[model samples]
Target: MAEEETELSDEQKKEIAKWFLLNAPAGEIQYVAKDLKSVLNADDVYNEAASEAFPVYNKSHMICLGMSGHFGDVLVTSYGELNENEYLDPKTAQVAIVDHVKQVCTEVRPATDEELPSPYIEEYRCALEAEMLKYVSEAYPKGVCSVYCINGKDAEGPGSDFELVVVISAARLSPQNFCNGSWRSIWNIEFKDDIQSLELKGKLQVGAHYFEEGNVQLDTKHECRDSTIFQSPDDSAIAIASVIRHHETEYLASLEESYLNLPDTTFKDLRRKLPVTRTLFPWHNTSQFSLTREISKELGIGK
Candidate 1:
């Protein structure tokens, strides 16, 4: 039955490819065919099948499969290598980054008079409050035009470290000016040193922040921080965008050199070499439930 289903899917894919070839522009037929080939060549369907068949597959396999499938082995390989060299492999560096972020992000618990208190919850709350206060003070000394903080867990899901989101209202900050200069300058200043200076015992990962402009007018001195997490709150989007754009351009210029260094192979071979799994959705896997529960416990929440 499974074999029949697989055959049917392949047939359907072929039919779709034929339809695309006939309907698409004559000049674009090759491109469409290439895309179809890539999709059919993907290893995700096989990995998914294997995962469904074997419930005991480990987390590393799942993560590798999912990330490698979705992002491609080249991207995963590059990112993994970069992560190892830049943050993971070096114990000292990894510790420094994690510790730095934790230190800067950690907060002393505020005293409370409530009876039957939960110390864990209190500590977590204090840490969050401190992080919020610190960022607000550093970025908006006068007071935030707006503030949005959502409590969540890290990318690895519930048992992972806290994911604290702090979105400061940039209504009062001049979007144009920030889009022009301040954002870029700040990112360049903090990007490397801050992460390098940290002394902790874990990997440090950062994501970029996005900006949305509305009706509020921003002051000239402030702007929305650029998307990079490692960038300082004072960094402006305009400068960072320009810098990133330039960097990409430069990177592309060296693609030929990079490509020459890689081995020539078909997409299918690459896909098989790197299976796919859903690593980003950690909650989807039941195996990690215990870890999640532990995280909740740490946060002083009911298991």
Candidate 2:
């Protein structure tokens, strides 16, 4: 990455500058600085707005606007950094910053196919999945796991990153309480090799439903008790555990505020917390894609 930095040419800088200028507001002076740090992609327009001692509107503010789309009203404010000297009034800063940004802005298009998948990302996903699968099979003899190659299109839109959903089934455990208790014991069997190095992804809800004779609904969390890893590899245990831990940590961190508000809680609340449907499963992705395509077709944007 460092070596690649030296190869960036004056033409590339001018191109970035052009993008900045086009996206700038109707009136602004565009100042092109060579050593600006990009907040997103390395090759994308860089931001030099922070380099000055005091906030002065510059070409970098235009770059920021171009990176963040112009459809919605955007307000940029400077909050006091660790140092107290960096404070700026939010309202005044918002207007001045936006005006400055508009003055030096340029239009930028979404990334093309050539820039979508970097070599490192493609290799990382492939290698990670393979290693996860092998680890699961070797460690958990009674459990089963499988991996599927997922295209970004069937879930989110084209610009979305590739996603992996893993499902695991253990014969000795029930699915309802599977994630709740003794997760470490289960993971011990699932990931016996280099567990720390593995980049666990996310947890998923996997289950099925049934109807009774009179059409009464039966809610069974572990409807499939066959002890088969139907969708993903057992190594997904790591990812699921990680997500659960994160959620717990976040919940605990907010406990003080939650406790303070508990006394005011009312019965029969209208607000919803979790989504009604299980969003982690493949079926949700299919439904979402179908709905999206239908909407796009209605809008005459379907390909």
lDDT of 1 at 271: 48
**lDDT of all the models against the reference?**
0.29, 0.32
Worst 10 residues of 1 by lDDT: 89-98
All candidates: TM-score? 0.17, 0.19
Per-residue error for 65 in candidate 1, Å, reads 45
| Poorly placed runs, candidate 1 (over 4 Å) | 1-122, 145-162, 173-303
Q: Per-residue lDDT tens digits of candidate 1, residues 52-94?
A: 2222111111111111112211111111122221111110111
lDDT tens digits by residue: candidate 2, 85-167: 22111111212123342332232233333323244333433444455455555554543332322333132222233433333
lDDT of 2 at 70: 43
